[model samples]
Target chain A: MCDSEGSCHVLLLEDEPMILMDLEFAAEACGCNALCATSVKQAMKHLDSERPVRVGILDVNLGEGQTCEPVARELERRGIPYILHSGDLDRQNETVRSLNAQLIPKPANANHVISTAMECVGRKCG
Target chain B: MTDDEQERSRPSQAMGNPKDFDDSPERFRDENPDARFGGASEVLFEQAMAQTRMAICLCDPNKPDLPIVFANKAFRNLTGYDEAEIVGKNCRFLQGPETDPEPVRKMRQAIENEDVVVVELLNYRRDGSSFWNALHLGPIYDSEGKLKYFFGSQWDVSDVRAARAEEHYAREMARELSHRMKNMFSVISGIVNVTGRMRGIESEAQEINDRVQALGRAYETTLDDASAGRIEIGQAIRAILSPYDVGESHLRLLGNGIRVPFAAVSSIGLVLHELAANATKHGAWTRDDGLVEVDWQEKGEDEQRVVEVTWREKFGPKVTIPADAKGGSGNEIIDRLLRFSNGCIDREWHEDGLVAVARVPIWKAS
Candidate 1:
């Protein structure tokens, strides 16, 4: 169950479909609505939709030699909080660090993802 | 040891003439007085230099431009230059735009100190081609200890350098492969963990197996055209549903060639598998004469491009909507998958069978 604020919409950007599904399921389990996108372009479309986004979760690699940095920047520009879930652990990306977003490496549990998204929205997980 | 000492240690026959050796007392005593003034030794020395495979050159240090005073046959052959064309020119003529300046600067320092130096650098030939040259240069002094000439020997090492570059590329590829493998394992572990927690062990194991197979199919698609980073949507669907096709006629697939993004292949395969499995148990695939038709097409333009897929089934026993149809796990899985892809699925039940339509955003292959 989510915090007292009921369900808030969270933008989810991940290239891997299964992982994207897992994140969506996690957000739903925590009583949050998930608006998912499998690529940066799709995520931008979601952003442009005027949807009320309380928070965001992003996977670093969007496949086809693309990344989610553009979406992350847009989220930052809008002052929305986000978490980065990535399989690339070796990269010390300055952009991710400078954004001060929490980074959860791949193979993360749904509980952790849910908790991180809740925390980004200023909610506490019981 | 000093050069004089090294010269004296050599056999008198190895020396061209007594005058050619530095005036070390030992060399003077070792020379054959009978042959001291003869030109026979000079001819033998010239023959030896001409026959050797190593490119050899002698540069006159006293000359204003340090011109090459002598060049061996191998030197002429290696550089595609005639002896007459190279004899009076500085060896720097072999350098061109691609040559790195660091080694040239090092060579300059060595020449200033009159020190022996070996450098591997790019050098141009008379034909305007380039070769990796391993050049060794040392000073040759006269009896008075004056630097008379700079002795240079060159070997074409282009093949060796090329091999080293190939080795570097292979190492980079190996690192990339390792990183990808690690990520794959992580994904597999996550699947096992999550599925086990959500379902009992037996069901978890089965789901894990199915998901792994889905991943395998995705990899097969990638291997088909490793460079494209895409797979045909129809091919991916066929691969997943082929196992359940039973009689080939039961399943029909039609599509205008649509290349799905590589990242979406595995998930798409999983969705197809789930749909086919449900049909096999309770839908059209339950009966011998039942039929299913799946088709997909791309619509919209530019950034708005979307893929629309429809699954229509008929000829099975009269369809009945189960009580849990609205909230079933199968529906949940389908919803999650479609939503993740920025798509939606609409399911309609008719007297004949079931119809499902899915519209998903897509990135066309550039």
Candidate 2:
């Protein structure tokens, strides 16, 4: 849920600028706070922060042979739920499967993205 | 006997007393007490050896280099060498630079121990062309138990090895192509979704765009990495509701993760999208204080794991039941989707807000 300032506080990890913008818009449209990260390193910084993250939306491949697995693992370890967003068809990596996180494929509708974030935080948008 | 006379008399002697010239002298002597050294049996044996398809050669172990003593017609043809050219040379003359030393060493070890050995190695013919030689070698002992000679047989297997390599390459190529094609489909689908949402579109166009977008979303979840075409219940719900901007403080969701069949993603997404749009316009999403709570859990003890999902709207504007709420397109779609999944849906209106519950069989024993 958002504070008085209307920030619901979500961790958004994506490499592509356009996709990141879409995710940001979706998070804000649903009245959730958006904390954006463009790479695994940046996402890890957000994860390390003291601020509470209600949920996470992660892109599987972050480019240059990097993945968001570490971010996903950290979220799971902290009991924070997350959803996977990827363009690659092969999404069944063993590490991610073990976490049992929800997968949302690329080019997802804003409604689906926002609602998934809401659901992760134990909320229903529709 | 003089050398020339001995050679001249051999054929007639072989023809006259065939049993005397048997390879196993002791066995021949036992069977024929009057056995002699010359017979027609030797001529018959030579004819058979010359006609056989397999290349055959005999090496004299008593000779310093184990020189080839006798070679059949097949052996001469296989090596492109005549009897005069090959007889004085050892069989090792067939081996070339490319031949693996390991098998050659094993062959030597087998010979030293007087044991049989079979080895495949590269061998060269008189024209300097190489071929794979599957060579089988064994010792031939005299009647007194002396190792008198070594017998070797050869066959060509170059074509078989080449065919296997080609098949392996083709398989690798096919796998690579499939991976590339899958990524291409995903890219094209992403493009369609992005293009459909462009501004200034008419209602009819937007509606079509929305349906296509819903399909894209369905494809995303259904063809997950596992490619099993099943969507997790919580994820499906979230994906369906993602486009709406229901304030987080105003929405609540609770559920244990469950997966549903792929066929249900689009229909269920459409229903949830319709409900959220309605709520945003006139129901729970209208006020900052308005809230919607959705929860789901697995039910029943049958082989199929059933999921019951509840959507409850609270603290919203008083809702008047729209005429279509009972029999609208949205309601029809929801009903059809539920029925397809072997599930059902029910809705209730209370003073606080509207509440709807759907029960769906998401998993079977399979």
Candidate 3:
């Protein structure tokens, strides 16, 4: 029952491979096409792609390496909804908190993440 | 009969110590002929009065300015004001700054209304030590049904206050324990998410645990340094990177620098471990000819000093465009390292080798 005119697309930006796989599984199972990116740049590329994504799942800390705040801001500006899934305490900043975005703390199962992402996207897109 | 005569007739010996009252003979001859007493009751009364620990005081109720007519030795000890000073003074002098005003006010109101009162009050001793005092005061009626005197008794309750303090401390500790447990749960969740997505299911859990354990060890080292009031950055680094070192040559530590703060050390350790693990798995040590060069030196002495680290790969399989390149593990690691605005990565992917140069901000040691 996919709606071609307004079918949902998700961008999952995670720095950890295990979490990325879990999210991918969950997104597909929920019948949503998910694009995975390991860094902010890759996520930006996906956004700039011909087929633009309308939603994103960002990990607060990418790894021992990068951050996704800039990408989150851009998504915010583009009117694209996003959720934060992270274990890093630093991500609990004022900007992130004010975005009123959903947070899926680490250790969550695939179903919970995909469902929450769907909810955020549904609320924002609708 | 008069009040004086009524008191004398019942038994003079009931007052305690017949020998001390030379006025008994005068009372019997002139006031009441039936008041003569024997030795036995007097001795018993004196003994009982001396033995009781409760502080007892007898004050005249009618005369607003009436003095304390009688008090036991315990009364003298309790008030720190000997029988001499307190006999003629009102007990209100016992109230001090820390005394609970409501109870004291209630007791005063009760006294003003001539009502019997039982109240717990904070009072001070002669030595200035404070104690919770349970005071019971009642008006003693004469045979004619006139409220003639007030009798008061006090008991100490300092022990109960101490028990309540201990209970409060225990509850605070329980709350702290729950908070710590939540943090631990989040950490475990992160570990599960990472390992669950790993290629080899059998080794995934173990690998995730190893990394978490490394993080835990680093956290402990920082805690230990904090407790000691000093940060041993080099020691913490050495401990964190212990698992990836195949031998001394594999890890060429360049900066034998001064100790860094615990916060910086933890961030740096995590970065080092991730990069080193990559080198060991896919980059240099992927083959026997692999080597990792590690070094750190301060750029300058400003508030924020730039600390640079480099990891160059010597020889390996022509670094295939990582089959899982989009969500490649290495990229994930590098991305996480750059989370701090003070951090950046400039990579050199050339025909000769692969080099990753990272710049991180450092806080000076206090």
Candidate 4:
């Protein structure tokens, strides 16, 4: 029942433009439509739209001390699964860790990150 | 104010080295005008306290208020007070608004209890400049168990505290630098992927991305215990295999206590990642029921010690064995990566899946 012509809508939230484009390409490669957002506000806006975002990938730190935790909690509320991707997640990042998401560390293979998301989508759909 | 606080400056006493020194309580009081404690040891003790560079003083407890009855040259020098300004005064003259009250309270409670206590507090100099003073004070009792005096010693620890502050700042700066370094790696890989996607070189981009990630994971392993200069070989393997170990009980690690120097961690990690990526692509991890068992063992003795690590896959689909195992481009990558570690790897197909074994030489820094 997705609006993008039966294609899976994947949310890609990252501060870096290059990373966002990279994630979009990866989502496209996985046969999903990428809903890219550089900030939490835009991400929430995308979520507020009736588009079905089946899965998400969030970068923990979004520059200037901002984090993707709010988006993560929103995704959790909607029962959508996601992966926490970051480079500088301090060892004691229990607050975000409590979201129960697999951390696909930065510099991850595009296929690896996308396939992990597809696996979550499979568990939710299959 | 007590009578002790009003006591004025007196001429400094001489450090006695008399020709006919007698070790008797009778001789102790004869020449030692500063002999407050009544014992044969008072002469030696008084001379030692008076001349030694450690700031020391004695307060009379028998008086209505504990008053400083004696102040040594070092005490006067440390507090920037002459003998007269310090003697007969409770050391509180040195405490100012900058002084923390907790240590003062601790010192007061210990003095009331007649017990030994040590604390660091701010104390002002004669010019009113504050210095951190490490103060140790305790009750001194005579042979008859009577409280004779309260002994107080002082030392300025401003330099030590400053050095500690500098160390904490440097540690914080190092953490910030390391965070920036990790971000640079992420950004570099991002650029690689974004450009690689436009150029239609996704597979090539992913290969570079994985190798970068492998290097990042290895660098992170070194950070866990950088001061130790070594890490358990199993821990290094676990970090590399973490990608495939998720979602189920697919990875079985069996080895302990075998350590590897940090110099070899990245190369070893690269080799392990190469094997794990191959397995996920064409070998065992392709199925849900597949299991990858990483077993390591220590071989040889002392200088000849070598670590033999075997990656054994179980419960997977059948596959054709590569006729020339070590000659393939994939196997060549594994060999080249392990070369930095002075290690070699071999791939062999078994009944279930691919099995790769790596032997790494370990130094006898045991």
Q: Pick the candidate with the highest lDDT.
A: 4
Candidate 4, residue A34: the lDDT equals 88
- lDDT score, candidate 1, position B123: 98
Error of 2 at B281 (Å): 25
Judging by TM-score against the true structure, name the best candidate. 4
DockQ of each: 0.10, 0.12, 0.09, 0.47
Candidate 3 regions exceeding 4 Å error are A1-126, B1-47, B65-67, B113-117, B143-145, B194-366
What's the interface RMS deviation of candidate 3?
A: 6.8
Model 4, B1-366: lDDT tens digits are 432222112222322421111223333345335445646566666556545667887788877667787666567668787655665688888899989999999989998999999999999999889999999999988768888889999998999999999978766665665566676777778788888888989678778877787777677666656657777767777877887786859999887877777766776777778888888887789888898998889888887777888989988789787677676555788887678667887777898898888988877464
lDDT-based ranking, best first? 4, 1, 2, 3
Query: Which digits, one per residue and each the tens of the lDDT, describe model 2 over residues B1-366?
Result: 643233334443332442222223333334335334457765555445645668887787877978877666577678887656777698899999899999899989888899999999999998999999899999988678888779899888789777878977765555444434433443444344344445533344345545555555544454332344466867767655655544457667777677666655555666666667667767788888888888888777765567777888998888777666767555677787778777788888767677988887766554
True contacts kept of 2: 0.13
lDDT of 4: 0.76
lDDT score for residue B346 of model 4: 75
lDDT of 3 by residue, A17-105 (tens): 65576677557656677888999889989888766686788877665456678888898898888888765433345545755577765
Displacement of the residue A91 alpha carbon in candidate 3, Å: 26
Stretches of candidate 1 exceeding 4 Å from the true structure: A1-5, A90-101, A120-122, B1-85, B92-121, B124-130, B134-160, B186-366
Worst 10 residues of 4 chain B by lDDT: B3-12
Highest DockQ scorer = 4
Residue-by-residue lDDT tens digits, candidate 3, B295-320: 66666567757666666666655766
